[model samples]
Target chain A: MAGGFAESGADLELVGISKRFPGFTAIEELDLTIPAGSFFALLGPSGCGKTTTLRLIAGLEEPTTGRIYLGGKDVTDTKTYRRPVNTVFQSYALFPHMSVIDNVAFGLRRRGIREARALAHEALKLVELDHVAARRPAQLSGGQQQRVALARAVVNRPALLLLDEPLGALDLKLRRQMQIELKVIQGDVGLTFLHVTHDQEEAMTMADTVAVMNKGRIEQMGAPEELYELPKTVFVANFLGQSNLFTGPVVSSGKDSIVVDIGGRKLEVPRERAQRHAGEVTIGVRPEKLQLHGAEPKAAAGTNVLGPGRVTDVSFSGVSTQYQIAIPGLGTVSLFAQNRDVGAVLREGAEVWVSWDVAHGFGVADDPADGPRFDPDDDTRSIAVQRREKLEAELEGA
Target chain B: MAFGAFGGSPATTPASDAAPRRGGLIALFLLLPGAAYLSLFFLVPLVSLILTSFQAVDPNAFEIGKFVYAFQWQNYVDVVTTYWPHILRSFGYAALATVLALLFSYPLAYVIGVKLRRFPLLQALALTLVIAPFFISFLLRTLAWKQIFSDEGVVVTALQALSLLGPADHLTGTPFSVIFGLTYNFIPFMTLPIYTSLERLDLRYVEAGGDLYASPASTFLRVTLPLSLPGVVSGTLLTFIPASGDYINASRDFLGSTDTAMIGNVIEANFLQLQNYPAAAALSIVLMAVILVLVGAYVRRSGTEDLL
Candidate 1:
């Protein structure tokens, strides 16, 4: 599977890359390849090693035990300047002293590109920021500066372009706008875009392929729909979106689907989608995939599974109404139903039936190697505490 | 009306009415000690110096160190005309010394702040060493340097041995020696401000520059130097202003000769040996005015709108 680099002309290839700081392992033997002219995103939670992978590819940091190839040539030992790669930094690291035009023209100027100013203007025009080309970075808003950074990197036309959370500093509205803009821009100039972000929604929105990382390792990599609909790990399921998870033992297997006894209730999931054998497994479906009813619906045949639950919480969002259902002998699970003009508006303390197609359910092989059993919405051990522990250890050694 | 429209909001009216009086009173209270101290120490000396600059001594009155005060403003003209060369030389030497100090300090500060940042212990050690000279007296340091470049000293001897200098040529009692001493003595002042600015610099810009394919040297010139201008301005000011009026380094009895005498040395000679207080006072006033003008022009030219 990894040998595709030879046939398809991989724009970037990282073979067994690992980066270790003094007391922390950033990435552990990561292997990834991106085909030319594709927008790929590395998505993860903080400290999950997505950024380290990008940095290693950009030649900002050297990997400890791997070779990095750009356009099928090993550039593992190349200096950042020598590497034909550019990065849009998270802070938009624009030279504060230079005008926006100069900032955009910086890469070309370094390469001794004649008519740097005219070309820089062309790049700014690409981002629709040529009007503000003469202004310094501080004079522009965060969104404007972000575009300039994009223009700067894109003007280089490097073999690989890495964006380290380029839209992270913008507000929600601007971020959404920029996300679409980025997708359009990527389409316009199809360099091998490698964007790193901790935001799952952003990755789903922009990248053609998304890699979900957890604790210095990639949990799953595929198209966003594939990862979301058929996540191979509980981490991917929880991280990509909210997934109502169930841990149970497999009762029977079929050519098409597998039936698992989830604490008593038998649920059928597509057999190929199940990453486990006929044994213990953890399975989940996204909140929106399950339907909620006032009473038990007639058990439909042909891959439809049914379960009885009671509505514990009712949250009516503008477009969708969400219900927290407490299944008997099973934990509470969330399900979102679209708000309709003619439907029974479910309320708290109402008896409800949660039903989903068997094909919607996905299963993982119930491994104990999960990185932090996380509540998707709840706080985990914060990075500050971990950093403090590292510092204290460092001090003690000192 | 525009000011009133913006300013006279009902929410802020009461605060403004009460605050101004309270603020003025508080401001007065805050100003009392500093203002009184300046009036006593600074204003008094300045008033006496200005008065002395306008005074004249009777050439016939042979009472030792006697001066009957008169509005003899020609003392300013006389001092400027007689000591113009010394004044120009002082400024020239100061400019050279300041430039030299900046050149030496930029690399030192860069290494300490950026290069050694990962090694906090080493960085602190290097910074401490940079500031260690302040522990020693300036006079002692200058005198030590004077010894190092004395007529038959090791520096001159080495230069002679290398044939870079003739046997009769010397490092002491020259413009070069005085300027060198000034640069050496003021290096810490130049270094610390630059270290502060460079320490506060975002390393990501350098990384971004590199990622853009700019070499390290070009990055330093384009990104690092421009951002560190505030520090350079402050460092140069700190070196130049003091060096311009420095007496110890250019004292004929110490490291300099008559030919190498600066404005400060001339002022010293007129005040103590010649006992021409008016000329010295006039020259002192001229030096202060020139420095003020030059520093203002410099600060303005640097366009440090953000820094100041």
Candidate 2:
């Protein structure tokens, strides 16, 4: 693993952290270490425990049984006010009554620090909101309010910063811009940021290290590229981005490679990615990893897997062209390609050859009843929220 | 602007620049009826009262009790000298009752709105209890309190048993009992508005305050209290204005003695017993003017002009 402040010691630690509400366990048996000064993200879909994990670190919620350490001190039993941590809430939560400067300097004034206004001015300047310091939060635009929230948290200079979907309220364009700005500010300030987000793209763009959480446990933790390319579970593979999976019994296992036959066609996968499976496995490749050609291509040196297919769906998504291809024997597969130099747009029913390198194929333990990827955007506290919503809809339907 | 705040889509968009203008026009139209009512009842009475305050009482020139409005401006000066103690006492009692009601209701509202929120049933029950006072007649409720604080009632008997009060001392008709009656009767007024604001308060700001290293007290004072000020302002106005002009609660027949008479009691006596309409009108005008000025100053100081 790469080393830096992460090796210096964990800035925040949670050991055996679990939180149980009256009806259900929100988070269970979770242990995580956010390296000092690293931009880390807890990424998952709406019902995942990523947000719960962030709340535990911010001292907003106490664990049912666990210890929380901040900068090498055990703060498990400490009050939230005494903990050296701060959070930028999803709603911004700026004091609607106070001016922007008062909102930003609130922590310092509580700490009894002299020259709080000066410090607040500096923090606002960092977010480029100093000019509007005298205005109330209600008077500011959404994006500006979000910046004030960011400034308010950073001004405290806490040992660790927790951001709970801090950019969730902004428009898509503003969210994209703030993602860049957040990364820059995290870099400049060098504060350990534990960002919780459901947006995979937001996680990938801003965090140096990403931990994809599901239910209440960490599914995978690594660099964004590693999690995207070498996902260990079907949930992680599909949740990070779209994936094409080939489920079949493993025919051969190798030190350098593994051979799996799919629909009477043999495809080779690199052995390094196949170590997690034994019997039945699914070899997965990302949609963008597959290359398409008009004619059937011969197996090349690096591209050991190749197949002929017919396009079932051709979707033009501005930046990339998405095509759903149906192999003769295989069910269906998805391929994404840059639209830059396309000679002609591929229409539905067009025949094509799809190929990818052995390195792109990774294995995951195949589950019998694997469903389609769940990517709902309306995030709340619990996984059962969706189920309850579905039940309510059904009751209304009748 | 109602739809604009929610951000209208291009498909269903109204005229952008004209939205707030149209909204304001509709608001004006909606306000016209209430404005007309206030002008007819409140504005007309107030103007008549101001004119009547300057009238002279010529007892025999008219009937035994009637008089022309002789524009005697000295009526105000004569009433101020005559009833200055009653005016001061009215304000003092109102101010004390307002402060007491605030202290009592804030914690109640906070607990109901924030602490008990997760228990919807309990929050609903608590809120109903707060508003339950309105179900009973106000006069009956004050009478109930008068009974509770009577010389031989449980409260005074307990105080005597505890040696906290002398056997001869009684709470039936004192300044304390009058203030207590005002506070008890108007508590719901102070609580519900504060509860409305507190109910909608985002707990995230409290969490944010804690995250910023503020103690619980600090968070309450700086965040919770300031955020709930709009409610506090409205609640105090609702409680104080009516309490100052309340004759029934402080009348000798109720919980108060003649010594504890407020301005409202004096006006009642002048209008009913003495049949002195000019003096009552002058006192009523002064009371209204005082309340308006005080409430105006208060709302301005609280920085809750949006509420007013």
Give me the candidate number with maximum TM-score. 2
Give me the runs in candidate 2 sitting further than 4 Å from their true place.
A1-10, A299-302, A343-345, A368-372, A375-398, B1-32, B59-63
Judging by DockQ against the true structure, name the best candidate.
2
Q: Put down candidate 1 lDDT per residue, A1-398, tens digits, no spaces.
A: 11111222247888999999999999998999898989999988888898888888877888889999888789999889888888999999999988899899888888887888887898899889999999989999999999999999888777778999998899879999999998898787777889999888889989999999889998889999898888898788877877888878889988888888887788888888889867788888888998777776887764445457778876655577667888788888888788886553977888778788877888875543454555432112133345557989999989
For model 1, how does the per-residue alpha-carbon lDDT over B1-308 read when each residue is reduced to its tens digit? Answer: 77887775776655656888898899999999999999999999999999999987777797756787899989988988999999999999999999999999999999998899889999999999999999999888888988999877889999999999998998889888999988999999999999999999999999998898888898888889889889899999999999999988888767888888999998888899888898999999999999999999999999875764
lDDT of 2 by residue, B192-273 (tens): 9999989988898888888888889989999899888889998999999999999988998889999999999999999898
lDDT of 2 by residue, A5-98 (tens): 1222247888899999888888889888887989999998776777878887877888998898888889888888887777899998898878
After superposition, candidate 1 runs with Cα above 4 Å error: A1-10, A303-307, A342-344, A373-398, B1-44, B151-170
At residue B197, what lDDT does model 2 achieve? 87
